[model samples]
Target chain A: AQSVTQLDSHVSVSEGTPVLLRCNYSSSYSPSLFWYVQHPNKGLQLLLKYTSAATLVKGINGFEAEFKKSETSFHLTKPSAHMSDAAEYFCVVSDRFSGYSTLTFGKGTMLLVSP
Target chain B: EPEVTQTPSHQVTQMGQEVILRCVPISNHLYFYWYRQILGQKVEFLVSFYNNEISEKSEIFDDQFSVERPDGSNFTLKIRSTKLEDSAMYFCASSGDYEQYFGPGTRLTVT
Candidate 1:
């Protein structure tokens, strides 16, 4: 079994300020962690993923996340938040072995960016 | 970049009516999946399909729900009798080994 938990349900940040969304996961297998962002009425876009190669993974839109094995955490961070970054973010986990990996998702963190 | 595509972006149906949600996954991907998000809720996996059959399914994918890869390009989910509780945003996805690409979802409203 694999599960994920997003620490914050809502995160408010000023544009150009820093952003952080925390996630922790538990799995029976070596899991792959991912951050996905969904804009209003839009589909989920993969922000980044960690498959055990690099501890720190960079993604589009200046977003990045560091997978901390010691902490069982994969926290998303952006040095500067953009207005367009305001969206609902989901932390997802899956088994590393299969393309048929069943994704377990956390209740999302809604990011509100203000100017 | 290739992306998954879903049809009828939104659908409104009466309770007990049947509805079909359509998708065209990224070509050459061997795995397909369906997930749904209710309002203010977490995204939940429904089912995963591979090799023209169901590989795995969550409990939420009950008897009323079925999946089909009837042709080469189209994958579909059919609800034999939709209930008011079935209202959600249904997303279709296709994946290779490392990543899954999702479609823009079909908003299903059963009134």
Candidate 2:
């Protein structure tokens, strides 16, 4: 079984400040972890993924995440939050061992960026 | 850049009515999937299709839910009888490898 949990349901940050969205996962096998962002009424956009390639992964829009094996966590971070960064972010986990590589998503954390 | 596309961006239907959501995935992708997000809830995987058949499906994809690739370019999801609880955003996705590209989604509102 593979699952992910986004620690924060809502995160508020001022523009130009750092942003952090925490996620933890449980998987019986090595898992592929991803972070996706969804703007209001828009489709999910992949922000980054960790497939055991690198501990720290960089994504578009100045977003990045570090996969911590010991902590069982993949936390998204952005050095500076922009107003356009306000959106709902989801943490997803998938492992090939699962029947069809099904992706399990977290409940999502809504980020609010204020100027 | 190639991206997935979905039709009927929003649909309003009566309970028990049938609805079809259309999608055109990235041209060369082989794997297709359907997912839904209820208001204020997590995105739930409904089904995954490959090689012209269902590879896997979730409990939510009951008998009423079906998927088809009627043509080379089109992938569709059909709801035989939509219920109020079926009202949600349906997303279509396709992937060549591990990274799936998602469509904008169709908002189905069953009244």
Candidate 3:
């Protein structure tokens, strides 16, 4: 079984300030993690993924996430938040070892970037 | 840059009516999937298709929900009889490997 928990339901950050969205996972097998952002009425856009290749993964729009094995966490971060960064973010997990592509998604965190 | 495309950005239907959501995934991708997000809720996976058949499905993908690749380029999700609860945003996605690219989604409102 695989599941993901996004710790924050909502996060507020000022423009040009740092941003953090926390996520934790539980999986019986080796897991692949991903971060996706969804603008209002838009489709999900992949931010980055951790397929066990590197612990620190960088994605588009100045977004990045670090995977921690010991803590079972993959937290998304951005050096400086922009007004355009306001959106809903989801943390997803898939069991790569199981050979299936089905993904389990978290409830999501709504990021509010204010100027 | 290749991206998934979905038709009928929004649809309004009566209860018990049938609706078909259309999608054209990335040209070279083999895996296709359907997911839904109810208002103020999490995105839920409906089904995954590969090799012309269903690879996996979630509990929400009941008998009324079906998926098909009628042609080489088009993937579709059909609801035989939509209920009020079926009103949500339906997203179509496709992937060549592990990273799935999603479409804008179809908003189905069952009244």
DockQ, all models: 0.79, 0.58, 0.60
What interface RMSD does every candidate have?
1.1, 2.9, 2.3
Q: Across residues B4-39, which tens digit of lDDT does each residue of candidate 3 receive?
A: 999999999999999999999999888999999998
lDDT by residue for model 1 (B10-109), tens: 9999999999999999998999999999988999999999999999999999999999998889999999999999999999999987688899999999
Clashes of each: 0, 0, 0
List residue ranges in candidate 1 displaced over 4 A: none
In model 3, the runs with Cα more than 4 Å from the true position are A97-100
Q: For each candidate, C-alpha RMSD in Å?
A: 0.9, 1.5, 1.3
Residue-level lDDT of model 1, residues A12-115, one tens digit each, is 99999999999999988778999999999888999998988889999999999999988999999999999999999999999865676778899999999999
Candidate lDDT scores, in order, read 0.94, 0.94, 0.93
DockQ of 2: 0.58
Q: Write the per-residue lDDT of candidate 3 for residues A1-115, one digit (tens) a residue.
A: 8899999999999999999999999999878999999999788999999898889999999999999999999999999999999999999998873334878899999999999
Q: Write the per-residue lDDT of candidate 2 for residues A1-115, one digit (tens) a residue.
A: 8889999999999999999999999999998999999998788999998888889999999999999999999999999999999999999999863224678999999999999
The candidate maximizing lDDT is: 1
